[model samples]
Target: MSVTRHKVWDPLVRIFHWSLVIAFAANALFTDPESNLHEWIGYVVVALIAIRILWGVVGTRYARFTSFPPSASGALGQLSDIATGRKRAHLGHTPLGAMMIYNLLLTMLAIGVSGYMMTTNAYWGVDWVEELHEIFVTWAEISIVLHIGAVIWESLRTGVNLPRAMVSGVKTVPEGIKIEP
Candidate 1:
């Protein structure tokens, strides 16, 4: 069997993806919540997300939002594909993956906002603001776990090197696999 390689993730997208991983891990696991480093990492995450949002508008073919918009029906179809063991390679993001991207983006923004509120005079020392920040962090953690698992599962099912694709900006898809445009 022959495999063909295609450029999927652009340079900016790849950088943003890995940079977010590092920043999120640093803030979530390694830094104290009250430390300056944690706050700085949070700011970095906000900036990264902002850049990604802009990239999704004017970036490469695979990086654009038009390449993979969130859709319930499309997600359902991907779910159905998984249930039946159907193999397909998505050049951009699969439907479920697209949904997850949007989810993490929004969740990170919420975390940033809540964390900022905790630093403000009006919301400082407020119990609910702190609680909301914690909640968003926890949700992001759970979502990260699920995201990793899904990537591995889909990679195995479709025989696509998803993690490598993110690193190398290319996906080596097996010939005859149906690739989503």
Candidate 2:
């Protein structure tokens, strides 16, 4: 079977993805919430999200939000493909993947905002804000795990090295596989 290369992720998008991954992983797994370093990392994450938000507006084709508007029907179709063992390659983000990306971005913002509020005099010791921050973090963590698993599963199912594609900014699609744009 022949394989074709498609340029999907731009350099900025790839950098944002991996940078956010490292920053989020550091804050979630290794840093103490009480430490200034943790706060700084949160700031970095917030800034990264902001940059990503801007990029989503005017970036390359696949990086723009319009390229992958969230669709319940599309997501359901993707699930159906998975259930039926159908091999389909998506040139950009899959319907569910786009939703997860949005979810993660918003969750990160929530975590950042709540975290900042906690340090302010107005919200100092505010139980709800702290709890909300923790809740957002937990949600983001869960979403991340699902995202990774889906990437791996999709890669194997479609004969695409999704992780490699993310790293290299290109997707290699096997011949005869139905492609979704």
User: Tens digit of lDDT per residue, candidate 1, span 1-181?
Assistant: 8999999998999999999999999998899999989999999999999999999999999899999999999999999999998889998899999999999999999999999898899999999999999999999999999999999999999999899999999999998899888
Model 2 per-residue lDDT tens digits across residues 52-103:
9999999999999999899999999999999999989999999999999999
Off by over 4 Å in 1: none
lDDT of each structure? 0.94, 0.95
Model 2: ten consecutive residues of lowest lDDT: 96-105
TM-score of 2: 0.98
